[model samples]
Target: MTTDHRTHARVAVVTGGSRGIGRAVCERLAQNGLAVVVNYARDAAAAKETVATITAAGGRAVSVQADVADENAVTALFDRAEQEFGGVDVVVNAAGRLALSPIADLDLEVLDAVLRTNLRGTFVVAQRAARRLRAGGSFVAFSTSVVATRFPAYGAYVASKGAIESITLILARELRGRDITVNTVAPGPTATDLFLDGKGPEQIEQLAKAPPLERLGTPQDIARVVAFLTSSEGHWINGQILRANGGMV
Candidate 1:
């Protein structure tokens, strides 16, 4: 079981837990003995399926529907966690939107939509997590290695994640004595719908080659890193961006 400062069973609220890497994190944390609050913006079916999988494994979980960008909705999301599992100890802000277009040609509307979900949503969730997570808790945000790679057609998506890295670092300092660790996990070319959606097979192969591991990362791979970051063993690691990219740099 994961260790809480109080040595009680910990609770986690994983935004975007309906599928992909977020779903993997929820499942892994549940296996580690943390009660999970699975948050989904729209995919209620997927969220319910995730909860069912957890419960079937003898893990406690409840699916919650909320747009991470909506303050009132996010507030209710956290309330459900508290009411169902006592209190929250970990929050993994995994909700994000990806749009591919060069900055010059990107529509302003598309930019707004990306920022609304990836940036504003992060802020809303982080604000609530900062206030709710118990001592010795953790808040992990998501970023992309593309922020460093400077990939073309990823302008809006990268901007949102770049802002997230800044928020993660500064918030770790802002929560100084609260004993809550805030960090970002920047993954490289993972094999998830979010990463594979529009890419061609050749492009995927080329990305898979960049990593010394010589393959695309699985959602489970990224989830394991998150599992550590939110656990007592990794609590000392704070205000850092861990790139779980198989040495892709």
Candidate 2:
């Protein structure tokens, strides 16, 4: 899946590139002629596999370990990206965790995890990208479509992503004079492990039928959009929450 005649080869850092949407982003960016650094928090083997995929396909990439929520680790991750790939050109904050619990039974620990990983983690990564990215670069943040649909057990998770959407506005303003753009991608319920875990057959059927597009989104679907948002063609698209949720909700 090599891209055609990429004018400028840039360096991109994709957090949580070990699996799901993150892996898809890494593969797409690598194919688009960027030397990507695939950052993973815990899945070392999966991270390496993404790297291998890129390398095997004749693209340049590396697997780096970092918890995007941890400031120190994130700083180190950015530093390493600069050291290894020259400088960071794009940053995609795709790493996230989802916990389902009703508000009454919502574990405080689960709430903390959700906030730390999705909101705070995205902030840390986006801030670094804003400060470190070169002119003409871009920063993309991930938010879930659940924020729009507002399912029952997804309250906390949606809240965290909602916070991401809020922060994206601020970050875009902060990138003012620089040619860099900041935006959020709100994906509809996709068929990722994080999304379809406990759904029974009936629930799955209902969900698949609910969306106007009549199917769950694939990683490749979201990945292609992320690639576009980070590309030169997306320069004018800033401070917008682009929803890629198959017209759902």
Candidate 3:
């Protein structure tokens, strides 16, 4: 696709946009003529690099540091976006952390952190977006294929994403009078740094082969779908969970 930079671009705020899927989503939105507010939790340097990448490519972008789990920080993030880009047209909640352990072995601290970051964080961000979305705005949240497959050791993560899916529906109805759409993108096992750890080449190969496509997904693959969902073309889709997992069940 061609990247046509515009003088006055639409505004978008993306969480966890410093690396991996978040970075790709930011780049794709920028290429599609949107000024991106790239939000990061702790990786300021990486977030800056993402912003630089977009700017160098003739697209507009800025890096903002905010922990999604914190309501104050999330409020600050939206305030900064509005101050910088006028008003936000698209909001993507892709910032999340994954911890895998059997329910028996799970630590309360780990569970709490996961819930705060994945569940509470999404609520805060989505609520903020719902309040500020433009007339035809869009809100995209993230889920995982593990929710469907019920993968062992993923109970906590799945529970969080399940909450995300439920919230998407609730928020969509809550905004019935508005033209905005709220949805979820549930990606299957992709070839991301977060998904590749503790696994070797053979393990990676096995995971990739599990998908019908015979390969793991790339960040770009997911980003393209997200771009469409937030763009004018996807305006008709609302309160849906579109899974981009290379056809993995």
Candidate 4:
């Protein structure tokens, strides 16, 4: 474990921090002077690279491996943060899985996997964070604009995200008076491997045009929103689902 002795600095645990939007969030939060615990389900190399980027920039971070869906693993992930950095002040549940298929054609197995990772995983992580995060902490969960778009072939993915939004609001209320804000980030067509995979140029172009900004959102764009919601200025904005997409809905 990489330890940062800055006792007053805020500590953040970002799941799926090894790649894509999760990686961007880890970097952004670290830049904001937070001691970050970068969590990854697998891909140790990618997780290491994320930590390297943060440390290279004079930020403190450590990469931990855990399956978000597993309660025990999630607990250990949080424990590592408290042990190494003092206490957790921010948690970004960016760990998720996506499966595309129209409801009629969706495989039960794929839907099960998506639900397990996106929905159940969010619950498991949120449960732990709710219990352990110090006062003034914040929890950010990821959702999708497709929930409103009702895009075909996205039933399973959207269903999982929808549940995330629901739980986010409820969790925020449950934490009332804790000074810990809980919110969900719903991003529209973002430029990441997760969004680009299985998408052709035409489909990608169409999505890019859907947003008023006329382009796919970058990982950094989404990261900025997460940063704000975790910051002191964003403390008052709790139990909200922020749509980071460029006016797509």
Q: Which of candidates 1 and 2 is the stronger one according to TM-score?
A: 1
lDDT of 2 at 20: 95
Ranking of predictions according to TM-score: 1, 4, 2, 3
TM-score top scorer: 1
Worst 10 residues of 2 by lDDT: 1-10
List clashing residue pairs in candidate 1. Answer: none
Local distance difference test, candidate 2:
0.90
* Model 3 ranges with Cα > 4 A deviation: 1-8
For 29-133, candidate 4 gives per-residue lDDT tens digits of 998889899999989999999999999999999999999999999999999999999999999999989888879988899999999999999999999999998
User: What TM-score does prediction 1 earn?
Assistant: 0.98
RMSD to true structure for each model, in Å = 1.1, 1.5, 1.9, 2.8
**Per-model C-alpha lDDT, please?**
0.94, 0.90, 0.91, 0.93
Order by lDDT, highest first:
1, 4, 3, 2
Query: 147-215 in candidate 3: lDDT tens per residue?
Result: 898988998899899999888888999999899999999999888888997879997898789888899
TM-score of each: 0.98, 0.96, 0.96, 0.97
* Model 1 collision count: 0
Give the per-residue lDDT digits (tens) of candidate 2, residues 66-133.
Answer: 99989899999999998888899899999999999999999999899999999889989987887899
User: In candidate 4, residue 242 scores what lDDT?
Assistant: 90
1 or 2, which is superior by lDDT?
1
